[model samples]
Target: MRGKAVVVTGGTRGVGAGIAAAFVRAGAEVVVCARRPPEKPVEGAVFAPLDLRDPQAVRGFFEALARVDVLVNNAGGTPYRLLAQSEAERHARVLELNLTAPLTATLAAYDRLRRARGSVVMIGSVSGTRPSPGAAAYGAAKAGLENLARSMAVEWAPDIRVNTLVLGMVRTELSALHYGGEDGVEAVSRTVPAGRLADPVEVGEAAVFLASDAAAYISGASLLVHGGGERPAYLDAATVNKEE
Candidate 1:
């Protein structure tokens, strides 16, 4: 990744921050953008201020960008709530952020990517593959996102590679808000087959691989970065009837 120019959207914090930091450590010139600024400067990354939800702003951002060799679309999250209780507007908002924003950004950056023969790594979620109970809309949006990546891969073939890193639970600074506390974190972690949440750095490493020459042959792939994913409930249900 040395000497490469990388752009990471929603790179102010959480998984996005980790991805940008990793690229910087690999000697890439990283440009990170978010609606708000990070609490502190990331050592080797330059910050770009923009809201990706606005199509015009997004288009302008990419047009004004220097040179990019990698683009990591990592800005997305769900506001956990049951679908029935949420308003249609709220659901649409989530979809716009999770799906539309990335699409707009990708299209805006297409030419530069083609010129550089660069890669685009989208930060997807495992919820898209399974039934997301509390966050139904988010799941639907992510499913669309994965499909969009596949289409983009074909449309931009031989010039750019597009892939997704479908993630599970990750331990970030925001973990406390989502998992409650240490005990809550442990309780949630236990549900995963790996018995732990993923480290953000590990996710960064995966992104690096997908963006590097090593994964040059890989395109339109949805790589599961979950900690073995959640265990099926039926396994334990069946165990209940077993003899001692």
Candidate 2:
């Protein structure tokens, strides 16, 4: 990855920042874009202001930037809310952020990726594989994202690779808000088979591998970084000898 140029969206903070830093650490020229500027520029990283929701803005951002050797479509999240209680517009907004934003960015970056023979690493969610009660729209969008990657891989074959990192529970700076507090985060982590939430660095490492030569032959694959996934609740019930 020494001479490769990588782009990470939503790179101002959280998992996106980690991914950008990882590429920089791996000796790649990393360019990060976000709606707001970072508090500080990552070492050896360039910041590009971008609003990925707007397709024209996304295209302009990519057009002005240098060539891309790798694209990490990592921007996305949803507010926690029950599907029934949410309005259609609200649900659509969630879908837009989690699905359409990446689509816009990917298409914008496609030409450069084709020219460079680059790869795309999409950040997916376990909620897509399982049911998400509080974040239905986010889950649905992620499920769509995975499918979209497969189609892109087929259409852009031999020139580019498209893959997904299906992430499970991850500990980020906003962990406290979503999981209550640090203690709550620990409790949630323990429920996972790995007994811990993934560190952002781990997610970044996986992205690095996907974008590097190590995954050159791998395309349209969904790599599960779920730490063995969630523990089965029925097993605990069985141990207690509970009745139906």
Candidate 3:
């Protein structure tokens, strides 16, 4: 990765920061972007404030870049909002952030990526693969994102590579908001086959591998970074013997 210029959206903290750090370790010149600066610094990386939702700003951000070898579309999230709890506009906002924003960024960076034969790593969620009762919009957007990546891979083939990192419950600074306090987190962890939430660094490492030459020829693929995924609910409620 030496001499490669990498861009990580929403890399100020959490999974984004972890990805940035990994790239830095791999000797890439990493630029981390977000709406605001990181509260804590990611050593060996530069910070660039960006609002991915704004098309004009996104274009300008990419246009100003001299070179781009890789793009990590890691900026996106949603609060817990049941389908009926929020207005359509609210749900639209979630879609804009999770789906539209990445598309905007990719379009803006297309020229540079094509020039460099670069790769794109999309940060996706398990919510997209299953029912998301509380975050329906986010789930829909992520599912769309993976589909979009597949299409992009087909359309932009032989020039750029695009893939998604399908992630599950990850322990970050904001974990408690989704899983509650420590006990809540523990209970949730027990439900996963891996018996624990993933660390941001783990997600980062996977992203790095997908972007690296090791994964060459891999495109339009969804890599699950989840810890063996969630356990089936029916298994625990079955009438079978405890020892099987």
Candidate 4:
């Protein structure tokens, strides 16, 4: 990755920060962008301010970049809201952040990416594959995001590669908030087959691998960063007992 220029959207903290730091360690010129600055920025990485939701701003941001070898669309999140409890506008906003933002950024960076034969790595979620009861909008948007990447890969074939990293629960600085508190986090972690939550750095390494030459032949692939995924709930209620 030496001499390469990598751009990570919303890379100021958490999973995004981890990804940016990984690129820096790989000797790439990493640029971390977000609406706000990092509390403690990654060492050896440059910072750029960006809000992915703004189309014109996104275009301008890309145009200002001298070079781009990789683009990681990692900006997105949605509060836990029941489908019937929230307004239609609120759900729509979730769609815009998780789905439309990536599209806008990709389109804006198309020229530079094509020029450098760069690749794109989208941060997806496992919620898209299952029934996301509380965060339905986020899941729906992620599902759409995965589909978009597949089509983008085909359309931009022989030029730029596109892929997705479908993640499960990651232990970030904000994990406590999302998972209730420490006790809640531990309870949730035990539910996964791996017996623990995923580390942000692990996700970062996976993202790096996908964008590296190691994955040159890979495109439109959905790499699962989940820690063996959650254990099936049905087993607990199964009438038939298994001999251990």
Candidate 5:
């Protein structure tokens, strides 16, 4: 990845930061953008302030770029709010951040990406494929994101390759908050077939693969970095005795 330039949205921390670090390690000139700077700067990554929701700013950001080898749309998240707990506008906001923001960013970077024959990596979630009760809006947006990537891949073929990374639960700094506590995190981790939460660096490595020439022929693909996914709940609910 030497001499390659990569942009990672919301790359200040967490999964995004990991992705940026991985690219830096791979010798790419990585630039990380977010609305605010990270508390601790990501080593080897240049920081650029960007509000992905603002179309004008997104356009200018991309227009000023000399070249972009990869665009990783990794900025997106939602609070644990039930449908009834929030208004439609609140849900719409979530969708805008996760779905619309990527579209806006992509369109703005279209020319540069096309010129460089770049790749796009959409950070998706397993929630999109299953029932996400608390984060229904987020899941819906992610599902839409994957579909959008497929269409974009086809529309911009041979110039830009678009793909989705369907990720499972990751062990981020904020994991304890979502899983309750250490014990809760452990309990939830046990539910996954891998017996543990995925590391952010692992997701970063996968993103690197999708962006590198290693995946030259790959496009419009949904790569699962779910660590074997969750074990079927039905298996634990079975009433029949195993031993006769």
Candidate 6:
């Protein structure tokens, strides 16, 4: 990745920061953009402040760039809100951030990416493939993101490669808050066959692989970084009849 330039959206913290660090370690000139600065600087990455939702800002951000070799669309999240609990407009905001924002970013970077023959790595979630009761809008958006990438991969073709990283439960600083506490985290981890939540660094490494020449022929692929996925609920519900 030497001499390559990479942009990681929302790269100031969590999974996005990890992805930026990985690219930096890989020798790419990494830049992390967010609405605000990171709590602490991410080693070897420059910070840029920009609102992805603003079309003008998005355009300016990419237009100011000299070169772009990889675009890691990692900026997106939604609070735990049931569909029935929120208005349609609120749900629409979630979709805008997760789906529309990335689309805007991609379109903004199209010229640079096409010129450099770069790749796009979309950070997706397993929630999109299954039921996501508390975050239905987020799930729907991610599902749309994957589909959009597929179409982009075909439309852009030999110029740019687009792919999605379908991630599962990942351990981050916010894990405790979402999982209740340490014990809750452990309990949740046990539900997965891997026995633990994935580290952010692991997700970063996967993103690097997808963007690198190692995956030259890979595009429109959804790489499952889910560590064997969830164990079937039915298996735990079954009762055994034992005769003494």
Residue ranges of candidate 2 with Cα displaced over 4 Å? 240-244
**Model 1: per-residue lDDT, tens digit, 151-223?**
9999899899999999999999889788899989999999998989998888988999999999999999999
Query: How well does each candidate superpose onto the true structure, as a TM-score?
Result: 0.97, 0.96, 0.98, 0.97, 0.98, 0.98
Which regions of candidate 1 deviate over 4 angstroms? 240-243
lDDT of 5 by residue, 1-244 (tens): 8889999999999999989999999999999999999998889999999999999999999999999989999999999989998899999999999999999999988998999999999999999999999999999999999999999999999999999999999998899999999999999999888999989899999999999999999999999999899888888788777565
What C-alpha lDDT values do all the predictions have? 0.92, 0.92, 0.94, 0.94, 0.95, 0.95
Model 6 pairs in collision? none
Instruction: Please estimate how well model 4 matches the true structure, expressed as its whole-model Cα lDDT.
Output: 0.94
lDDT of 3 by residue, 194-225 (tens): 99999988998899999999999999999998
- Per-residue alpha-carbon lDDT of candidate 4 for residues 1-244, written as tens digits (9 for 90 to 100): 8889999999989999899989988889999889999999999999988888889999999999999999999999999999999899999999999999999999999999999999999999999999999999999999999999999999999899999999999999999999899999999999999999988888889999999999999999999999999778899878798766
Q: Which residue pairs collide in model 2, if any? A: none
Per-residue lDDT of 194 in model 6: 90
Error of 6 at 84 (Å): 0.9
Error of 2 at 133 (Å): 0.6
**Candidate 3 lDDT for residue 228:** 94
| Candidate 6 lDDT by residue in tens digits, 1-244 | 8889999999999999889988998999999999999998899999999999999999999999999999999999999999899899999999999999999999999999999999999999998999999999999999999999999999999999999999999999999999999999999999889999999889999999999999999999999999899888887677766344
Between which residue pairs do clashes occur in model 4? none
Candidate 4 wrong stretches, greater than 4 Å? 242-244
TM-score of candidate 5 versus the correct structure, residues matched by position: 0.98
